[model samples]
Target: MLEVNHLRFSYGKNPVLRDIHFRAVSGEMVCILGPNGTGKSTLFKCMLGLLRGWDGKIALNGEDIRQMKPGERAKKMAYIPQAANPAFAYSVLDMVTMGTTAGLHGLRVPGKKERTIAEAALEKLGIGHLLERDYTSLSGGEQQLVLIARALAQGSNTLIMDEPTSSLDYGNQVRVELQLRKLTEEGYSIIQSMHNPEQAYLFADRVVGLRDGYVIADGSPKDILNEELIEKLYRISVRKVDAEDGKGRFFEVIY
Candidate 1:
């Protein structure tokens, strides 16, 4: 459903993404795996149209993303940042309602119909009970789920997440992971950048390994990701204990 072709970008004289190429299809979860400075976020910014200049092409469902209007882009892709900082104490429903207003006009407030959309989005994520609660008062996991619901309310089935679980604890991280997997099962194309190789191996249907601004490998995790690549990516020695349901993949510091 999404494709990046020969994408290249830079910050002044320093190039961050070089000749990056990949594609993500419907009902699939693609993880861009790399450590710091590997151009994962840079590539995301480029795809999201936040960064431009000297790039080949990025298309969403056959339409060039660079040529898409802001409203059009909002309808095609939803970005979930690593963390959310809400300045106002908006209710959970209120926060999600904002997403439903992407195509709304000026001086317009969300009415009952919009509220219904927002509520259904939350319900899809199984958090409808928190509708009236304050957004900032929820736990990190709940807050993240709310963010995902907000993205859903925007009417986009494709999600681009920048380290979606980066700020949450282990339990919440697992919770979000399960939700992500579920979303993909429900036919949402999810492209996420993550530092945790284990998460990629366990959760992602396909892995795009980025290192030094280049795509070193791209394929199924079990095929492209192994002990050697794990060490190469993070410069650390951990184990990739193959087991069922991705439950046995774990990492520990070597003495």
Candidate 2:
């Protein structure tokens, strides 16, 4: 459902992404794993058309993303950043309902339908109680769920998130991962940049390893993750163990 080819981007004289080529199929969960300053975030920005001045092609559903209009892109792609610091003190419901702005432009504001979608998204994320509370006053994990609800309310086919579980505790992280798996099962394409390799191994159907702005490995988590590759990419040795799921593919990072 999403294809990126020979993608290259830079800031001033320093290059960030170099000749990156990958694809994500419908109902697939792809995890982008990379170290700090490895251009994972930059690639996401380019995919969302948030950054320009790059060389190469990014296509969404067979159309060049650069040529698509913003609103049109919004309808196809939903983005949830690693961190969001909204300036205003909007309620959780208000923040999530903003996702419909691109599709609900004719009206002065979001209508009942839009509100329903936003509220449903929040409820699905298990943050419905926070709907009436101030978004800024919530904890980090709560804010993250609210942002994800906002993205879901956008009603897009592809969901792209950067470090969606960066600040959450173990319980919350598991909740988010299960929800992500559920989203994929329901036929949504997901592309996420993640720092945790264990989470990637458990949740992602495919893993793309990036290092120094280059594509290092692209394959199934079992095919791409190993002692050597883990050491090379993350400078750590991870031990894989038998999982309770009996899938013959479950692993854990034994630091």
Candidate 3:
């Protein structure tokens, strides 16, 4: 389990996150929902140890992450950032193999075991055919999947993604969401920051709503993602409608 308590952060004197608290358990998907610049990314940076001077606690499986070394932390969690543009056109397999570096020693190169792990990750995400392709040549969604495969190869039980579907088309968005759900079912804890409340409603077991650096709400998506909260979060009118198939609900913004 991942637990965060009374988390607070600031840039110099400009406070960003305050009293943020949440927990994500294995086999569960949690979505952090809020408008842009509500410190969602900042909160993620704090959890990932990319930022310092944070006041509070972030722990994974009862161990304080702040007390762990960089390599030790990587063993506990993995982060998938927004799609990156690689300077060099590295092959998909090479990119995925990079995840194994944290587990390797000095002057030691990836051999059969690392290659196998990378191959397994790609196969798990149904992208094994792209193994020999250049990562830069793939579409946004494919690149995103490759990044996820890298994280999977990292062998952490917890995955943190920043706007995993932000740059994808409708079809790709749905595809990524479905894959995330599958990962959770396979017992990988996922924490992703997203701006879409409907995605939260459809895919998240828990939703954490952040507004102006504060946790405005935290609960199951069905209970916490109502029209009122939607309006409050985005400052825009929206309505919730039951899906035709009755599997779940979706939010429609009223412009």
Candidate 4:
């Protein structure tokens, strides 16, 4: 349900993203993969309309994102950053309820039904116990889960996460990955930027590979995660092995 065409962005006189084009459909989990400084995150910001002065068009369906109001855009898409640190010592429930502002307008309060939905979102992420905890006091993983709960509370049709699993340990990474997979199965379009190709191959329906501000490959993970492409894009050797399921495989970089 998201489309980007000839998208371009720059910092000062230096260009960072060039002619990037891709489409993500409903019920699809798409991963944008790239090494450091390749502009994967910049592409996302452009799509979210957080950056201007860029050329080309980004739209949800046929409507231009630039034309939509901030609240309107928030209702259509939710963004989860690589990290979120709350300024105040807000309660977890209070932080998540902030997402409802798009639907609730200027007010920041959540009614009984909205609170129920927020609590359910927390429970889904397995962080129900943190509801009453101070956000700044929680651990990194806990805070990440709370931010995800906020995104879920936003209840947008599309979820755009930047390194959603970046900071967590291996186990917590798996937990969040599973939840993202479940979200896609339930009909939410998920677009995530990741540095981990293995996770991208394992969880993404399609992979969009970026190199030096341009899209190099966009296809099924199996097709896009091969040794040649990985080596060329990231300058690292990757090995692909047959997965037990037969329908998919596992990937790892060879040091």
TM-score of each: 0.95, 0.90, 0.97, 0.92
Q: Tens digits of per-residue lDDT for model 1 on 123-153?
A: 9999999999999899999999999999999
Model 2: per-residue Cα lDDT over 108-181, one tens digit each: 78989999999999987778999999999988778888888898899997999989898888887888788889
Better of 1 and 4 by lDDT: 1
Model 3: how far residue 195 lies from native, Å: 1.0
Sort by lDDT, best first: what order? 3, 1, 2, 4
Worst 10 residues of 1 by lDDT: 246-255
Q: What lDDT, from 0 to 1, does candidate 3 have?
A: 0.92
Deviation in Å, model 4, residue 79 alpha carbon: 0.6
| The best candidate in terms of lDDT | 3
Per-model C-alpha lDDT, please? 0.89, 0.88, 0.92, 0.87
Clashing pairs in 3: none
| Deviation in Å, model 4, residue 26 alpha carbon | 1.3
lDDT of residue 206 for candidate 1:
99
Model 4: lDDT equals 0.87
Task: List the candidate 1 regions with Cα displacement exceeding 4 Å.
Answer: 244-247, 251-255
Which residue segments of model 3 deviate by more than 4 Å?
none
Score residue 91 of candidate 1 by CA lDDT. 98
